[model samples]
Target: MYQCEHGGVVRLKLAVDPDLGPLAAELSSLARGAGLDAVGITGAEPFGSTRRHLEQRKAAGLHGGMHFTYGDPARSTDPDRALPGARALVVGARSYRRAAPAPPRGNGVYGQVARYSWSDHYGPLRDGLGVVARHLEANGWQARVLVDDNAMVDREAAHRAGLGWYGKNTALLLPGKGSWFVLGSVVTDAPLPPTTASAAGGCGSCARCLPACPTGALVEPGVLDARRCLAWLLQAPGTFPIDLRPALGGRIYGCDDCQEVCPPNRTEDRRHPPPPAGDEDEPWVELVRLLERTDAELLAHLGRWYIPRRQPRYLRRNALVALGNVGDGGDGRVVRALVDGLAAGDPLLRAHAVWAAARLGRGDLVAGLAASETDPEVRTELAAAGLTG
Candidate 1:
């Protein structure tokens, strides 16, 4: 009679094992001892609505530049593809949404980085899951832990395991823990029993997250249009649509506007602590500093926290878009940076720089860009940037 809470139409079974009780207890304690918020176990199965939503998101070209693993059904949805012998998944969640410090307005422009990007969740999550896997291995079971890059839909697994439910923003929302948590999982060949109950969310008519999106990316409950999603725009690897450039505002990296506006995440107690020192004080990361970060500087600051899957140039290009959105031609410092940035070898980098320079209304920048811009794509960007303001 038990069913997946989020994907209720799908039938699932709980393969209970007597030994799992102690192991679950041990994992709960281990996760907490290691600073994790919650952890649970579930069988390997397709997360009902996620597959449908992912297909729709991809079909609409909303995927932007991110070719998500799940975008391919054979590779992502099928548990057999990820691990031939996989039977159950051990899912874990952690809270990284800290209380943001107040922004010192007027003194400087602020840039918003998505909460997840602010820290490195993979290392700790992987390490903890590895420990959990080892514990299961000791009990005569085969275990393997995977992070965000893997094919499995982590939020779906966690929800089915009674860890949380999908929110209107498409994030996993736990009852008391809030939606600010990061997820981790350990897929194993062992036949561990599944949790008796699925995490049917208690959203209860609360549509707080639906209308908060600036781009209307969340078309309906639990659906996200990645094209309109500013987060995707920032992460896209190639030239962005010039029309949406202004809506990007001062966001140099990822956009937290949607999450920032989430009611569940707004609670004061659930907020994480402030950045320790020598970092952006509050409201958000600053835009001027984002535009100024060199490749090495960006890697040095964020490389440890973010997965180095794509080249760092993608992020630099995003910075250019942000700078163009906020930069005024009057600010000689930013203009010079944009001018200098256009000379870089990466076409994506050069292209975005052209756009930024144009937004700042620098005729000198256009001349300089014309002198060095060889890539046809960049030349197009230069022409577009020049026409913008």
Candidate 2:
């Protein structure tokens, strides 16, 4: 006997036969019905190759202090670590693609947000996976859901499940579907058969994503150096790299240049136009407004994002960089934000503020602080900007 709940209604189906094919099919259907765009199953064998890649990358400093999967490659690559006796993985991908909204018309400079972070897509993805997990558990099988979590290497699981191939950008590109999806899985003890047919194609000869990378983070096919990735740098702690700050452009969080240029992604968008962004989607943020917010206000607005050590200052740090690149120095509001940032008590903020002011041709604004600035890091920025004689 198997039982599952959908839309607050309990449904039961008899599984008289010992075969698990029917169960797997039903779970896939449930996942799709629950809003997942794709679903596939794969064995729970450890991702040994992936573990080696992570270890090698971390050793080479390609991870750029990223601690997610790199923090514990062994633990992250092994599904059994997530759920003991795990025999299969039911992977799901929820599409995050949507028609980008027109840039908000406002008085302040706007910072671009990566498509994935525009909304809480992961929350819905988890709910969809939960539906499948609950079904498995109701049938007396142990099931655990992992989404955007370090417990499992989701892309590897998705690839093995025949969901997609690895793109040069290191994203799982679904056949005809592109890479604009968030992936997750339900690690379970069930002995479901894996998807036999692999995603029909590979990224052969098309290396558009490589040069498309603003910072050359995609050093080679299917490899990314996080140290130079604008997406990672925005979330990274400390000062944004001085050399890469100009390329940072107006992005306050995440970078999509690679996928934006991928042939498959572009084609997908043409064939199946995505729906308009929802009201809740935040594709752009006002830089001056964001800088003006109080600590509590900033956190309340963007707390869902992965702020380094959960500090609000990092958010301001990013905004300051974006302001430097896009903010109009002539705009009084922009100057006010830079002024606030330069005057901030935290040296980290003050240092980035100095860079922003100088980049916007407002070096005069930093002159006043040069005499009084004592922090070594801020002093370095001042000297680099030539604000200090």
Report the lDDT tens digits of candidate 1 across residue range 174-240.
Answer: 8765777778788876657776555455667877777887777788887777778877777665677
Looking at model 1, how many pairs of residues clash? 5
- Look at candidate 2 and tell me the lDDT of residue 135: 99
For model 1, the superposed segments whose C-alpha errors exceed 4 Å read: 1-14, 46-49, 104-110, 198-200, 268-297, 305-309, 368-375, 385-389
- Measured against the true structure, the TM-scores of the candidates, in listed sequence, are 0.82, 0.95
Residue 92, candidate 1: C-alpha displacement in angstroms: 0.6
Give the Cα error of residue 174 in candidate 2, in Å: 0.3
- Candidate 1's C-alpha lDDT? 0.69
lDDT of 1 at 286: 59
Give Cα distance to truth, residue 290, candidate 1, Å: 5.5
Predicted structure 2: lDDT? 0.91
